[model samples]
Target: MDETHRDRDAEGRARNARPRDGLGRPLPYGTEGVGRQPEGVVRSPEETLREAQRLLDGGMPFHAHEVFEDAWKSGPEEDRELWRAMAQLAVGLTHAARGNAVGGARLLRRGAAVLEAYRARGPYGIGVGALIGWARELAGRVEPPETGAVARPAGRGRATGGVDAAAEAPRLRP
Candidate 1:
């Protein structure tokens, strides 16, 4: 078989090897390509949170969703809800970035709902109350930007007048 044919098979295998991207999109093959993160490779909570924050701050919420997902899948069971909620938040941002206001609002509210129970104690030092408040506020404000508007300066995504402005990466509370 030719190298091209062999490469295609290898890519297919890699695509099935791990979790998909935020939108459930299948990642391309190879290290240089966009692929899912390796399974069973969990990181420290601090490390994962920090990395997710970095991705979000960089205007890459879709990538951040991947990190949060890993934490949800591999982190301690006790922390699963926290990670899942965080992942949902990231995906919500992803939807907003892609200009899907309704989907974004839905995910944002859903995530906040999961987070509500944890707000009293502030799990993992995360400001659960603040995050919940933020999510609810964001959900109310989400509205897709007008067509042909200028994107955000940092290449984060399209920025609408009200809710979109708040959609930028939220500061993770200590």
Candidate 2:
């Protein structure tokens, strides 16, 4: 047997080679080395939003936020504003994960404000639309107790429970 047949786990622990799939076989030749992209395709604003959503799904909110920042900076001015807002929201969530509720809420409000500023424009795009709703909801919730934290303004609770952040951001390449 060739050494190439050997397989190892992340820690280099040799284990039983289980069947690749339900069929009990290895992946096809052309697909063996294929990997998912950090960000997905971005043919348009909608697609880019979807990519950011994928990052969110994978629990890489900071990375997702970075992706959105790239998209926002490269996008047109009108589109940039909304993208930046969404990016900020992603960052806010990251802050929340670190127990910085005040900072999170602050970023969330800023993002919501950006979106609200453009609510009248045609199609805030799916990612931003959902984010706007989320930011608004987050704005209303009492800030989690943080040392030396100051209270921030409450968000206006608008209809719509808020978009699913996971579904809203997806990995995409533009």
Candidate 3:
């Protein structure tokens, strides 16, 4: 029997298998592995917003984007733009975290622009204007010069040299 296939739980799922490190080397047995599952379909707007906010607050912008994408895919037709814009904003933050300043700034501005149309009365009471303002400020911090270099703003606590993730992270309005 193959050693790699030796450990299995009652349900036949891998049990005592060692998780791999970034280099693909097997980690010590019992080492905890970090994993996040993308959120499933959420029909309620309130629930979607709440989950997205929780993810964003936890500094998991990519996960937040998944939640927003679900909303965009499953929400009412009239609210498609709203959900898409929110997802775009989350992706923008994700890109910034990954050190893609130009891409991040572009998505941020695009998301803000989409929300600007609903500034007077955003869906689900979202503060469109405030969100747009935040996006603009973050974009300013990530200004990509002609050389395509992204500027890292001070005080963001990120070692990747980009916008301050915590400082520039968007807050969803209740």
Candidate 4:
């Protein structure tokens, strides 16, 4: 693609014009794709959590990540880490569904740690502990196959290679 044809926002920053799948994977141009969350929208913490939960419940962790990303970038400094960790958790789930076991596990652990640490201090109405458990469960599932160790979903849900795992996703405000 030529520079002249690149997708550019009003600020002249380059953005991918390519449509993305439900998991946020870029698709070839001209191919119809799932609708994604809008970028840079400011919302209250409640609104962000609500919308992100909706996306996560609908098996769209990648989209949820974008919502959290918006919150992370636009929210008050004190809450930035909370949103950033949420985004990381969502992306970690995305990797798990994509079957990148090592990457997925790493991210899940990283996000879980952040959230857990934050929980000790303050996490508002968010169920930080439950969210940590959910991420940890998924992380255990994403362990390398050669390890002969994998955490089975205990009536929570199943992994379907990133297709749709709503049951396996966490309820953010439980």
Candidate 3 structure quality by residue, lDDT tens digits, 57-173: 766777778888888988889998999999999888877766777777888899999998889987787878889998888877775554436554543323346554555667789
**In order, what lDDT does every prediction score?**
0.70, 0.58, 0.73, 0.80
Worst-scoring 10-residue span by lDDT in model 3: 16-25
lDDT of 2 by residue, 1-174 (tens): 343666676789885343332111345433443132343334366666666666677655666676777777777776788778778878766655444556666787888888787666535345445557767676555245445455445552212333334443332222
* Best-performing candidate as measured by lDDT: 4
TM-scores of all predicted structures? 0.69, 0.55, 0.71, 0.83
Candidate 1 local lDDT, 25-99, one digit each (tens): 444444243444444557888888788787777666777778888999988889898889998998887787666
Q: Count the backbone clashes (under 3 Å) in each candidate.
A: 0, 16, 1, 0
Model 3 bad stretches (over 4 Å): 1-34, 147-160
Worst 10 residues of 4 by lDDT: 154-163
Of candidates 2 and 1, the better by TM-score: 1
